[model samples]
Target: MTPEQVMNIAYQGMRVTLLLGGPLLITALATGLLVSLFQAATQINEMTLSFIPKILAVFAVLVLTGPWLLKLITNYTIELFSNIPAMIT
Candidate 1:
């Protein structure tokens, strides 16, 4: 394949990867920030306090977005597979 085609494929793969991972990562980050703020305000100072909430938030996002995420990855895989012959040429 041409360099342009290879780059395009790599770009698409990264885009899909980010799309797939962005939600969970963002959820965890937001959750952690909120938990930290709460801990600070309450003077809790418990390092492990944020873990559960972060996990729960990420899990909730994953659960809520699971179907859409699945469909997205499935579609991307299908499209990539379908384009394989063209890519080969």
Candidate 2:
């Protein structure tokens, strides 16, 4: 493949990866921040306090977005595979 094609492929891969991972990561970050704020307000300094909520939030986000994420990745993979023969020639 040409340099431009290679770049396109890499960019698409990154996009897919980000799409798949961004939500749960963002949720975890938000959960951690909120937990920190709560702890500060209540004067309860518990280091492990954020873990369960973050895990639950990420799990919920994953479950909610799972189908959409799968669809996105499946479509990208299908498109890539469909073009492979053309790309080879």
Candidate 3:
């Protein structure tokens, strides 16, 4: 394959990865920030308190977005595999 084709494939793979992971990561980040602010305000410096909320929030996010995430990854994988013959020499 040409360099351009390789770059295109890599870029698409990265885009798919980001799309698949972005929601969970963003949910975790937001949950962590909120938990931190709450801890600061309440002076509840317990480690488990912070950990539990983030875990719950991430789980909720996964539950809510699981179907869409699965569909996205499935579509990407199908597309990539379908294009393999074209990508080959």
Deviation from native of the Cα of residue 61 in model 3, angstroms = 1.0
lDDT of each residue in 7-26, candidate 3, tens digit only: 99899899989998999999
Better model by TM-score, 2 or 3? 3
**C-alpha lDDT of candidate 3 relative to the true structure:** 0.92
- Taking all chains together, each candidate's TM-score versus the true structure is 0.95, 0.92, 0.94
**Residue 64 in candidate 1 has what lDDT?**
100
Ordered list by TM-score, greatest first: 1, 3, 2
Question: Candidate 1 local accuracy as lDDT?
Answer: 0.94
| Model 1 agreement with the true structure over 1-89: per-residue lDDT tens digits | 99998999899999999999999999999999999999989999988899999989999999999999999999999999999999888
Runs in model 1 deviating more than 4 A are none
Q: Could you give candidate 2's per-residue lDDT for residues 1-89 as a string of tens digits?
A: 78888899999999999999899899999999999999999999889999999999999999999999999999999999998997887
By TM-score, is 1 or 2 better?
A: 1
> Poorest 10 consecutive residues of model 3 by lDDT?
46-55
Q: Give Cα-based local distance difference scores for all models.
A: 0.94, 0.94, 0.92
Q: Among all windows of ten consecutive residues in candidate 1, which has the lowest summed lDDT?
A: 39-48
